[model samples]
Target chain A: MRAIILEQVDRLLAAQSGAAALRRLEAGEWPEELWEALEGLGLPLLLVPEELGGIGLGWADAAAVWQVIGRYAAPAPVAECMLANGLAAAAGIEPRGGFSSFGQTAPFGRFAAQLLLEPAPGRLALHAPGAATPGQNIAREPRDAMTPGPLLAEGALPNSHGPRALRLGHALLRAALIAGAVEHALALAVDWANTRKQFGRALAKFQAIQQQLAVVASEAAAVSVAVSAAARAVDSRGLEGASFEIACAKVVAGEAAQTTAATVHQVFAAIGITEDHELHHTTRRLWSWRDEGGSERAWAGEIGRNTLAQGGAALWPDITARDIS
Target chain B: MRFELPSLPGGSAGLRAELRAFLAEAGRDWTPAVRARSWMGFDREFSRELGARGWIGMVWPKAYGGHERSGLERVVVLEELLAVGAPVGAHWIGDRQSGPLILRRGTEEQRRKILPGIASGKLAFCIGLSEPEAGSDLAALRTKAERVPGGWKLNGRKIWTTNAHLSDWMIALVRTSPAPEGGSRHAGLSQLLVDLRLSGISIRPIRDLLGEESFNEVTFDDVLLPEDALLGQEGAGWAQATEELALERSGPERYLSSLPALTAGVDALRDVPGADVAVGRMVARLNTLRGMSLSVAGMLEAGEAPAQEAALVKDAGNDFEQRLPEQIRALLEPEDMPEDLRALLADLTQLAPTFSLRGGTREILRGIIARELGLR
Candidate 1:
């Protein structure tokens, strides 16, 4: 945990120089150039297995990168790209070059060489101009809503082409999202408390507010711990066991994100909610990311129901260090 | 009466086998949904069946319709119930604490009146200690009941009254006097058994974010109950409330609510080559928690007060419960899933936010633990 945290700190230190772009992101500006530079620096492919000539990091490592990404509030698709590539690498496949994903909204042509979408039917070939090829140019939404578009294209590919990388990589990305959002929210909150004056005293002096901030700190750290455990599960136990840890990871970490963001807004008050503040960017992104993969309650009911069916104990097998070893 | 239960008694294995046979029949052909009660919904009949099997109120003496089981023996029964998600919700409160409370304090007549039904699984109870104005602050309650002829006329309201509408009786707290000039007003509060059938009493369910109708806005208006309704002494409600809170805060239920989702999560990976090892790690932590909780129960059974330990266990368990939903979601649908699963996952994930808040928010719990540790 300490090593991973230190690695994250190093990542943050490297990105510290990108502070100016972070400010622009707060103003709803998508610094595509800076993001492009980050991708060039291999920050986007941080979770691609080392076997794939990538960083070969786990959920915790991805979380560390995301923490750095969060500090700058970078309006880049790093998490999105990592999610796409991580699973492909895991499944012994490699997806090279630029691909933008079509999730909730369509991402138009901006900085991508290709479009990434879930599998579609042959109907596109029957209807569209790129019908002769295996794929067609399609536009989709950028991960960060604030990103500006270059152009739009409407086309689709065959149903067989959906990227497998997103399957496993998505969890890592979501955890990164939570970790990033929490760090940024904490930063925004701590800054406000330190500088903002209330009743001729800093807000930090109030016990009520102090207690609230401490809770935020503890929750974020706890989620971070849970996510680290999930990464360990995947690394040690492989995919089958990793799912259980992931359940715990998403629920706890997601709540940490939601609670931290909500509390950050409350602690900062009017200033935090405004478009001009960094808090808005982190909070809004958190809202979008929380629903992207799955919600916490869905997982709880699932975990509990599954335990009941077992008619014994929960799914803790006799895992030893040698298992992962 | 400190009842010592061996960690791995010879009877335990035999009892487990017997319970399996009994539950297989009692729970025969029961729908899977009914078996997994905490997630699907609560059932009363199943609990009654368990009661008939002497499972409910298993710890009390046989004279009270109980099985007079030891602590370890009772633990086996409870572990099976929770592990299988038996619809024990109806009898959960009654069996866990209400039966014990009645046995400890109620007059012989009151005990006979309630314990038999409770042991028979005919009664459901909810605690009405929280009010809209008073949540974490239990002693600050203003719901007052004055001296009247046949009984005391009640007039205050309680919020977050879980299953109050379905419950036959509510063990509630009300202020018997003015705030008492800040000299530890906790002593002036009193507890009463308000039968839900009274016409003057009203229970309006409070709709929560989850759209679950578990909470009720219980209103008391000129409700009269016989003075024999008072449990213990008038000035003793505070102590009683503390003891009840400790009981409430302790137990496997605190951590086990998310067991179903966790099970589903592990199940999805069962066919995978490496799931066993991962499941083992998760299970180890859960077992560790369960062990701690059981040890606390053992302490409680030994006549040792373990409020701080209970609070710690509850908060830690809830913290884990709150994490289960999101982590599972990430595992199940690491990326964007199909539209329907996504919708279902969204609801479950949203449901995780309140686990910490429902029992006792993390803050209040931390405060309790801190006070226990003498850190305050």
Candidate 2:
């Protein structure tokens, strides 16, 4: 089952390589063909329940697809769609899937078929992307802000007054995406360091370059593990209790993505910054994703506040409680 | 590609609960300062208690007093111990590296003699690798041992040897012969087990900034060891030592040293605005570091020598551990903190510098990782 999921994602990512994604972004267009292919594979319904007309995979399994999409910086709302399907499943709504965006403020609002908005906890209003004032994020990705209009469908989620689930779920999604991009960025940096030479020696032969690459590699590795743990937390405990681990994953992965982007790009100097290169696609998305999940400071504040609330003695148990086997 | 994490083994939950129960009672009296030391806090009685439960040498064969548990089980126990600030330091070196090295490389007679003692926690061990001039560069060590009638005679000086003064034995990496012509710098090195109570040996405690005498410098002047004391083959010390360095680098001790301080800071800041986020941020980083470290343990359990990944974990773990004190201070700087929290922070601040210095320095660990990445 894991192999099939990875192979399926790998096939799509190979079809939509980094270069292709970069071109689409540069052309200011979404990859309709890519979205169509993923939707044809029932990709967005991965996290929805089997009873809910979806494959019923856990958040961890669903996250693997997002990681792959982030690896190539796939120019589609695959994450948004997956998230929307998940929310819809939770809300007992069958998402008539196309490219859908779900967030406090959904990006690519102009391209989405339906927007899942959680203005308050437990109450989700499905609506068309109305009044989406056109805007672009730092990465030039479609990020139009919108005031959620009249609901197409609305329901009260049980024990949903607190939006911890949405907040933590978003953090988990962004963490998976950021980790994937950072891993690829590190791989690219390693390739550059090992093959690129200066003064008749490979850049990797230089201690300075090696150190930088090493730092990025560590960051990438750290982010991957953290995201994996967070995914597991969500898989086991649901969002209500998993927020601490999710917030941790977000802060750690977010911090790592920022450092990794700077270090990996700096290792390439001018070449990485060029439009002809696909490295920017991953780095730009990293920049966007890190900020998307409330940024490091935002999540850090949540974690800090949670820890402080527990008092000093209970801190160990809080951390140990997440030690899943 | 190797970054894919391995799954934690089954039965870890049961082991974790057992350890937690033990820790709750054992560490009931430990203050934050005692907890701040975490794995570095030594208590002979506590170590023996763990040994009695067969937690030490858990992966070795049952014949050697081991419980024959899986590597992941050992990781679970160790992680719980460090997380709860258990004082297992008296037997930490033995359980973590020395005993494992002996079990793998020691002869039947040597294992029979040493392994049971370690497993019983009756024996304590300390590393004798670093010299005054050979901190990061192990091959540059000048410690020498020469063939003698019944065994070998050793002469060397080891610095920054943790717990050497308290340990019953020392595992010394010595130059058995001069480096061969045009040979690897690592040639002719051997690991010899030395009786710390040998007549010719002397141990002097070296105080750190925290005024702790846990670090020591030891001198060996013509100490004699039995023939079987040689671990593995002579001149195979470098390869042998490198294999277990993963065990040293990937343990929870690498990251959880400063957690007590952070947790205390969390308690102190509970009523402060935004304290959840502030303390939560540090907790989040720590949880991630634990995940990364646990992944290394998984790799080790699969019998894959993930030296580079272990290096990555240690490098990342050290950075997190070292920065934690300062990060907590920065987060809670505006608020007037309690006295206990203030004291914990001060202690952690002083000890944080040692995080990257011990095991392998950050530069060296990164260099190893870079080399493994095919970068060097």
Candidate 3:
């Protein structure tokens, strides 16, 4: 990672800043200062390219930065901002201020600064990626287990309704960020292992603990390597490798992060589950990070689609081409 | 990186094709039932056929009866056999690795005597490392091998010796010396080729939770062997065992147990519902995993030990594989699934529980991964 990224990451983590300060961010709104400070570092403009007044780093460097920020359990839009900005730049549009979410159409387009509908709209048309609803949710009532929500982008956004384009940049960036989060979870587990003790000795000495931690560490490292490698390949091979590489990397990393977070929390014993333990934040961040990127199943499904389309054999070279680097 | 299913150099493709044809024909009648395809599910006939093609001992030189093919090429063969669910338990240990170990470390006579039969697919072998109490704790092993006139006399019970009752020979870890306080307890465990058929040895089947008898508990009652039985060197078993395990503990076999159920489900639905969508996802995951796996194999072919990389493959691949059963549950059970699919899922759920256990537990797998990351 670049020293600048690390410095910026450390500065935020130094204060445990952002929505992290809120007791229940899963339900609460994001803070204003955190967003302002993040933009001040040009985080939102990261993918804007130097030509677009942004400090454009390669995906590997970007992934590493995301991992560091993830370790601190920062809020959603930090990395998301970077990705949306990149997409805006790629579309050759100068952004005013708006965020983009990928996948099928979001109803309200809450974060969308402007809609680049898959089917480019004709003049005087306010289009909608039609029939776009949020992922299936629990029935709303006291009779059922209703998930608390000020749901982000729940209903349709005015007249804009139709099928949408797959935002490749958003997908790729989310994968990278998720991979980074998995790496972060592994690190948190390692740090916990070093300091946490049981039976009058450091817990790191336990065979069960060591092996689990090692697996988590290895997974994150390998995926981190793979994701970065894929990112580099994107430059050389264009989009071919990036999709599969990022998809594979993200799915692997996401699964690892999900499992590792639970495993680490388990190893931390009862204290880890409490709201105040430092470990709580690690797992919480992992939770949010995964939801932000969709679930592992979603990404795995995408990977399967891309992979089957390319056939298994093309995957290696597809991501390893000269354009990827 | 994506991996191309490489054609074998020279006549290797022909050999793979021949093996593929043989397995396809042999398994034509195989259903989820009547097929034990566990460690004991090895096909002696298939082994003999592979021997006939001179495909075994593939990584070694020709002097010892090996085909001298590249490891990368051999990976394709290994993967296909496991993927196709071929009955390869008979000669798997010998063909896949024991032959290479003996060729690498055994004397001329040892290589000549062992390698030829292995290549020809006549000989069979099994590993003996775990004990009744030391299944995952290799350092806790109490099996002792004492020095004697001609060679060492082994006396101790070896537990979880896969297919020991059926094996002709064994590559076993026996304690030759004791560990002092805080010493490397895993040290002094020598690896030797213990002839299982020799007198005074007892093999007992340790039925797994699946009711399969692939694992065994073998007690060596002063089992005698000549000086030549010592593999590599005395007191070198720990490293040798670790090396062999690096081969055993990783590979497509580590995670491909669910492949059959996956294949069956996909085939059943291929003509039905949106099979294209479902199959594509599974194929993509398998492809990426295969890519990573092949890269490790390439590293091994280039003489780079890919233990950690292989561990990553095993962990991720197994996790991915395990999820396949869960993924297609709905399609399989459309209005409450078929008996076959239910049984298939049940079978996979039962048998694949220890995908991470037989070689090394999932925790052990993780330790290897973490260490590679410089975190521990």
Ranking by lDDT: 2, 3, 1
* Predicted candidate 1 versus true structure: per-residue lDDT over B1-376, tens digit per residue: 1111123334766666677677667666544344433522457787678788788888888888888777667866776566545567788888877778878877888888888888888898888788988988767788998988888888989998778878899888898766666588786788888889988898998887767787789999888888898887886888887877777786877776666555555556544433343444345346435645666677876777777677777777787667765655645544534443344345556566666876677888876644432223
- Docking quality of model 2: it rates as medium
**Model 2 alpha-carbon miss at residue A158, Å:** 7.1
RMSD of each: 14.3, 2.8, 8.3
Candidate 1 TM-score versus the reference: 0.54
TM-scores for all predictions = 0.54, 0.92, 0.70
- Model 3, which residues run further than 4 Å from truth? A1-166, A197-200, A203-215, A218-257, A260-285, A293-297, A300-325, B1-26, B33-39, B140-142, B178-184, B202-213, B268-299, B302-350, B353-356, B363-376
- Deviating ranges (above 4 Å) for candidate 2: A51-53, A129-131, A146-166, B1-25, B28-33, B331-337
Q: Which segments of candidate 1 are over 4 A away from where they belong?
A: A1-325, B1-8, B22-40, B271-281, B334-351
Q: State the lDDT at A301 in candidate 1.
A: 45
- What digit string (tens of lDDT, one per residue) describes model 3 on residues B232-299? 88778888877777676556776666666665565455444454556555654665566566566666
> What is candidate 1's CAPRI-style docking category based on DockQ?
incorrect
Docking class of 3: incorrect
